[model samples]
Target: MTTMKVTERVQGMGGPGRGGPFGSSMVGQKSMTFGPSAKRLFARLAPERVKVLAVLALAVASVALMSIAPKLLGTATDLIFEGLFGKQLPAGVSKEEAVERLRAAGDDRVADMLSSMNVLPGQGVDFGAVGTVLTVVLVLYVGSAVLGLTQGLLLNGVVQRTMLRMRAEVEDKIHRLPLSYFDKQPRGELLSRVTNDIDNVSQVLQQTMSQLLTSLLTVVGVLAMMFWISPALALIAIVTIPLTIAVTGAIMKRSQKQFIAQWRATGKLNAHVEEAFTGHALTKVFGRRREVERQFADQNEELFKAGFGAQFASGLIMPTMMFLGNLTYVVIAVVGGLRVASGTMSLGDVQAFIQYSRQFTQPLTQVASMVNLLQSGVASAERVFELLDASEEPADAPGSAASVSRGRVEFSHVSFRYEPEKPLIEDLSLVAEPGQTVAIVGPTGAGKTTLVNLIMRFYDLDSGHITLDGVDVSSMPRRSLRGQVGMVLQDTWLFHGTIRDNIAYGRPTASEEEILAAARATFVDRFVHSLPDGYDTVIDEEGSNVSAGEKQLITIARAFLSNPALLILDEATSSVDTRTELLVQQAMAALRSDRTSFVIAHRLSTIRDADLILVMEDGRIVEQGSHHGLLAAGGAYAALYQAQFAGPVVEEESLV
Candidate 1:
């Protein structure tokens, strides 16, 4: 049940029209058990293991250097204080005058600390030593910054290359997936996995991976310094750690669920927008524009609520951490001041402890703040990996290859269904003699297309076998089988390319003469000559720039270029006008003259000349003969033809 919900939500992301970047939903997704998925992601980074390890080493070195600086600065402070009162002071100076002078020159706290130390009169300050310590401190900070920059540059290449490889894997996965998988998924949602989800993973790796490592190192290094200076003060700072954890854990618990809801809502909204935009004309024509808008508004409002809850919860982490940190700092100061006054700790030691306290807690707070980013990255990775792990089309058997020397196709007792319990095609048997024009006519849902799909091996049968030239088609590789068959679907598909390129799509090695000849044979040359660029004219997406008839002609030309031994025409001429349809039919008749062909048509008049007409009803052939022979029998085909040619009443009278 959980898997189903996750799959549905992920598959439903990025509604039809209002697509967006993954960041829009990042704050709203719930944290999940990304342990396995995250491990997989790290495995992807393994190829760049050397660079990654180098970056980690730099981060550790940088943190160690920076951590030591505060301690070094403290030593300088102790040296300067020693210069002030180390058995050497101004001549004839009373104790009160020295204390007042120290106060005027520096902090009162430092003055009191200095006054406690005995000083000899006429001692001068060592300004040169102070200058040396300050210069070393500057050098350490500069070196740390340089290491950070070098790590950043190397990390950028590692991240981009990893993401590139991941995207390539996903593209390959798409090709291996079954057509049925796509049939159950939305195109927009799948596109989101490839585009938005992969991009989010990239962002997280680029932005967070280094910070997470460096922050952790800083926290560890600073804590070591704190304990090394004064365990008592370090203990005081440690008290805030559990409290910070408890508070952040509680808040994240509340917000995590909201984030999940937020991302799911975003996906739903995107899916709706994608659907509405893709079918905008149909929606408007059906007066469904208002309904679509209402659905979108509802999904958007849900996202707003989820986003609000998530952001509000995560927003509380930083300020709460800061407040608790400040409170810890105050406690550390009071205790350290008492210890310093009693000479248990030096003024310089007290100052170093305070700095270390801030440094330790700062990285803790930063890591806490990164929880949302980490969660978003994991969620996106899970979505992408989920697609990669989906079921793929069954592989063809090894050494089962065969060649189609003849196009004699036959289906022997084929049985299949899209769903197991609901059978659509049952115990179907048929034959198409070599070079025969077999016309299959059926009403909607009568399995006309499904029959051809079986013959083309698009869907494997549950029982029996399909054969080409008396050999089982299952013995041949899919590519080899499809290579011998040419198809022109009712819905024409033309990519954004030149007219000549579109025609040569199936056979890229086709010569210019062959392409021009195919175009001429399909009557595509009629319109090609009228275009501004002629054969070089580029077609837009969906071929929207050209008329439907012209687009169909291009597809027909593509099929002609392939010149296969068998053809499947599914309502091939339905897009053309009467005159053009006649011309296309003539061309198809000539094309099928020597090749076995399957023509599925609704227009009874079109298939009257078929060598054999198979009239179908409810997934079975109710009658089979010539067009005249079926009419003479007065069965299902005769009734259908009569209803179309004569009035329904007259057809009923003739049937009775």
Candidate 2:
């Protein structure tokens, strides 16, 4: 039951799914269980791939460029400090007063104000030194900004393209999938994968991956510059690298699992809401509003907790890394300052050490926070690949023609189960001549619908074979075989279009006169004519304006207009009132001429006129004859007939 429902929802997912710098490795082998079939699903987005690589390169360069500014500022401080605080510098006035005069001679703010890079009131600078510092900044800092912009644009492009490609492939898979796949999932659950899951990937791309690359570059570049300034200080700063990574990695790995659970729960929640809304009438009639609301509330709350848990946990990384990084920086700065005061290092070198210390921690902090983003992108990628890698039906046989007119159909020792353990049909064999009507009558779940499903090639049988004009359906093109079969279900589905469009659906080439002829024969023309625009009257999805019987009649009109060589009618008049049933029956009868027809009926009177009647039990045909022959057999069919049509002559008459 679970599998069948999922496959049904899967069919409705004939659309896209979502992901983005989506570093997700493959989900645990579910996609790969389909083998080489999965390869076709992740159609390569080469442009996105190129841009991702390009942006990563740009990010590295931008980080390197940014590291230059701190060093240049350090250089300006050293030059001015040497001039102002030489061997016999003014002692009583204080270092602050000495630095103030150096700035007036062009040492600038690097050796003044609240740490380096200061603005002092009444301070003046040599124009030449000011121009020199500004020049270096313009060359280095401006270069970093330009590179950052380029990387940002490219990363955005790559992420968007990857998502588009993923969605396209998932959608394509949906259309190509066998009908049975649809029975396995929910419509809304599948929808969430495309929209919500893909968006998660995009979010990572827009926010996380870029941060990760930039931070990684910063870490690398800052370390290099710190080494240039003071190898001793740089080594001290590197002490926390492994511990930081271990902490960040552990937090992200755990959150990845939570994020998956969160997304799955969110999909379930969406599925529940969709189910409630779609079956709103049932919920109201059963007075189940509170029940549905409670169910929704539970699922909604679960999503909230799971989502908040995943994000809240991931959010902890930045602050934790920041604190650890700052602690490391303070340790390095104090040790380096003591060395400078002992004359073991120059003031210029000490200034440079402090600048490099800032470079070390800040970049890694950015990198640490991006782990969460990377994890989300990866999780979404796994979901997308899951859909794409699902099993698809076999390709049409080679050398099979697209068009074939052999309209005869034969069933040979056929048996089937939606799943292996539960058999629905077994060892049933029958044949229908051209222009003959073969009616199959059985209780619900007796394989009446499964038999029709096999004929249309909607599913492959587990045992034996079905043939169209002696050609095995499995060996022929599925499309060619189905092209010859026109089916009408009890439930009529109408798209948002005109009445004429609905009738002409089967054959868009059909003329207005032909559509009218079909509608009139089905008695839909009567009601359609009553509408303001008659045949041109607009309809909505599922045809809300019409009665169930009227909708079914219109669908029958469409089938008639298509003029299929083989027609399958399942419960043709099952839902209609007696009057509408009568009208639809006339149309059904008209549609059966000169064609191979299969009728599955519960109303025995409708099948009495069929060329042959097969009574099925437990997936096999137990009785085969005319209506009277089966009635006389005194078997399961007879028992069922009497239970439904026994007692008195009037009771039997009521069946008519």
Candidate 3:
């Protein structure tokens, strides 16, 4: 029931790989590199400097408390050991007397071991001292836990607020981008950048920011504690640092490339899926289901390969780091045991040093594992930043002209092209006097729609100017120039809302009476009153509940409600039935009274009464006159009129 213009089909055939409007293939697009992207991502947090500083300070304090707790536990261990073994000594002997006696008895090793224990020869364990040390350790852990929780809460707030601002800026950028930009980019690709990529960026910030800071601080604190306990053991532990760095650095460098490829494949896949869904009915009717599915499978496989590479590379970090850490742990234990036996270090200090060694390596492992999230996040951030950095539409002229008083429109030597070398409309000149109905007729790709687009300033002229009521459209604010124009395209768009709300979209502040008047004038009232809910009937998301003709009528009502000075109808009757077309043509006739109207139609029957008829070919007007006059002159218009109405069917090429 819907007509597909030849021009539209031809345009669709040229997409992506076909060297159409999209220009280049997306196969080898490269994202920004990791170093610069990470820098930019962190720069976005500059506005929350206070919160970030607070989070860092809390991380430092928490790690400091947790780092000291293990040493205190070692103290408790010493107390219990001295208490348990002190029972072997002779009763009522002073500690110095027993040590001298042992030395006199030729037990020098035992005497020295007793000296290292630092216990009275006859004393049992001090339960009170052990209890006190354990109590202090418990308090330190609880304080560290509290500080960590507060830091997480503050960090979460900072990330959410930054994401909120980023989403708003992206939306504003979308509005400021030129229509030509959209012509080259798929809706799905842009949508993935706005939604999926931003969400990934948010997740990365929330998960990695605080944990990365804590792990780094823990490394510094634990290393300091390890050196304080015993420098030799600390040096043994530090030997593995260079090896861990080398392993992590190598894995991260390769994983980052795969991560970028993964996200790019994701965007391309999303674009394909969105296109398929939007055109599901057409795809099924044309029996292109298998082709669509094959394309999807191919893209899906690409995503899987890229994702596997990224994950496998990043996954190597944890196990390799753990293996290195275990080797360091074993070395530290053997050396510290020898030192304990030689009486160069106390049993308590050696125990504390072993715990510090584990703490030191654990943070390094943690940081290595977090590199995966960091790389993925930076990859997504680069995509979002690319959108933010895209070339925006030129700014409107400063102190521009405001409103148009009359609907007079003139295009003086206007020239433009979507591609620089392939001019679509060149040196086109025309005048639409106020209150005149100009009906333009031509075959597909004759630049009918392009001419209307120029008048509306959807694009700027490469050379020449468009004037509205003697005021150059470039000088006027886009909002002001577009405010006085109403357009009804062949495709009817309706959001999920009530019938009345859709009609009122054209003039948000219109009263109930004004809306009713527009509906009646556009024949929308005829259908609305028949429905059970009248004006309040809700349209579904796709607006599929209503027939196509009803949808077109509603759109006409919307434009009618606006009461714009200049009106444009582009194949507006192409979707409706013959009876419905009659109603639409009648409504359009009423709407055109006292208003300058530009109607582009392929149906010659519908425009015979137009005040002016223009026949265009190859971006130029080949003939122009009133409908009767053009036919009587027997030129291109006459041939087109004969082809449609009177003669034997003429070939489309011959008419052109």
Candidate 4:
């Protein structure tokens, strides 16, 4: 086929584009080395092997058909040339001279075949044969295009479905992972893996996978056809392969490291953006905007350097390969012309060989470029699998029933540490009988929150048993145990939803009346009605439209709706004004009257009326008694109370 015809047929097949020495295949690729991660990726793709095989089959057929067109067009060229010029041989030419002249104009095969079927020196060329060849070329081109489009459509489905499942798996894996997994990782980094990295993998599957396969097949088909036509010329064309490899090897060795650095910098940049944006208000309040911007600029500069290095290196492959290919083309032209003049090859064969040479080298260039895309794809896959393979939360004990009747909770000799080197909680034991209010007060980092976490089974104790109603909390499914316990933390989280929806989050089936009752109990109903949308107003992410105290009340309403056997209020009302605090205190008193409650507070005034109070310092409880009893004893609780009442500075310094 002519270069124009071939170009049109392979346009969608990711053939070299116009004006670019290497085309997008090479330029857009990231790295050039597939690592062990590729094996796992292939294994994951194995289930779709039948579809992939079909794509390969279509690619092979398409390349094969296109390959045959060039040779056929060459034959047609010779037939027309000979028919027009055969009769014009010099007058009185000897038979041997005539034969040599005919042989010089065409290949020995075509010359002998035409001579055997001669019509006469003056007979016109066979237009019908040329028309037939043209028709077959048209059909092949059409068939190849149809197959290519079909393959693209099929692969698109496969790729989208694969990414869908992969994303879902990652999301599920996130839930299964222990809370500790999130403790050490930046939320933005994990977000990058789930989004950006997976997107890269999807792009490779959708655009590069079929192209890589077709390019390989085209290279092989071209090689076979080249050898069939003339082994000598094919060998000359093949010489460029080693040169291409050498150029690629030298450039990619440096570029691969850059690709890795680029992606790492990308993740860091994303993390910085997430933090900066999430805490923009705090950053502004603290006058740290300049510092945050500096950090961001540093990350951006790193990404630019790494990205430029990678692109600059990979970009060299195309132009360098193109130059070598052109050099090969020149050699073929000189040698083929000599052979044609020597009566061994035809003019048409020389033309076809040149076209075949271009076709052959194009795939080599494409495949070389594909190496980078494949490696980048594999790298992204590795990040994704890292999450999928992370340690999951330990499974709950089998056959254990979820039966917590009374709200009694006990922490029995619970020794725990976040890290092995530093023990945070040691031999801590506590018990709250049903319907008793147990208030825990502590200095910052005194393991008060850690103690509550153990009771909620958020983290398993290092060496102790936390039981709910005499049943080991670890034995029950985490979901079931957590369902019976309600916690309202200081950092009130409200998703982007209506005020009513936020309150009803823990009990979705709660009726409108039930929701309103809980909201009223927590005083959430006080301001909600003053808003334009009433309870239906959409809360922005982080509840930016609402005050912190309002957000805290909404969360309290949520916990109240759950009506769990056990309740935890961790500075739940610290944001409210005195009036609202008294209202909340009344609500808390009523709620705590029938359920076990653990109240952790920095403000000494909130839990003074508790049935019991435990004062903690340095991960150990230093004092425990009723509010009056502790004050009378002049212990840690009394000292904390005195500091708070004495002065704000003293209170801030004395309490966490």
Best by lDDT: 3
Per-candidate TM equals 0.88, 0.82, 0.93, 0.89
Error of 1 at 24 (Å): 21
Residues 1-656, model 4: lDDT tens digits: 00000001111111222211111111122332454567677676776889878878888888889899899888888878766755555546543566667689765654554453323455557889889988998898889899888888878877888888888889888888876666656656668888999999899777777887788789889999999999999999889878877887887676777767777677767766876787777877888788877877887898899888877777777777878888998999999988776657777788899999999888888877776776567767767777787788888889656867788888777777766665566676778888888998877656566667777676787887888888888888888888988899988889999998999997999999999999988888899989999999999987878998999899999999999889999989988888899999999887777889999999878898888898876445778889999999998888888777877876777887
lDDT by residue for model 2 over 1-656, one digit each (tens)? 00111111111122112111111111223322222322322334455666767887888888887888887776676556554434334545555676667667775543443133232333334447856986886799899999999998887777677777777877889888877665666666778777888787667667876776787778788888888877888888898798788888778766877777677777777777766777788877878788777877887898898888889888989899888888887887798777655546556567767777776777777777776666666666667667776789978779665443656888887766666655555566778888888888766656677778888778888878888877788887777777777989876778999888888998899888887888888888778877888888888875778778778888888898888988999887887888887767777888898888999988876877787787766545767777777778888667767776665776768888
Q: Against the hidden true structure, what lDDT does model 2 obtain?
A: 0.72
Candidate with the larger TM-score of 1 and 4: 4
lDDT, candidate 1, 1-656, per-residue tens: 00000001111123222333221222122334655667888799999999999999888888988999998888778777766665455688766687788778866765676666544455655678778988998999999999988989989999999999999999999988866676565665667778878898899888888888888999889989999999888888889889988998887777766666665665666665666787888776888777777777877898899888888887788888988889988999899989887657887788888899889888878878887776667767877877887888778766656766668988887777766656666676778888889998877667787778877777788887889989887777788888888999888899999999999996899999999999988999998889999999999986877999999998998998998888999989889888988888888888888889999998887788898998877556777889999889999998888767887778788899
**Per-residue lDDT of candidate 3, residues 105-218 (tens digit):** 998766776677777777888999999999999999999999999999999999999999999999999998877767767667788899999999999999998988999999
Q: What TM-score, to 2 decimals, does candidate 4 have? A: 0.89
Residue runs of model 4 more than 4 Å from their true location after superposition: 1-33, 90-97, 100-120, 648-656
Q: After superposition, how far is residue 297 of candidate 2 from its true place, in Å?
A: 3.4
Flag regions of model 1 displaced more than 4 Å: 1-32, 86-121, 647-656
TM-score sort, best first: 3, 4, 1, 2
Q: Name the lDDT of candidate 4.
A: 0.78
For model 4, give the 10-residue run with minimal summed lDDT: 1-10
lDDT of each: 0.79, 0.72, 0.85, 0.78
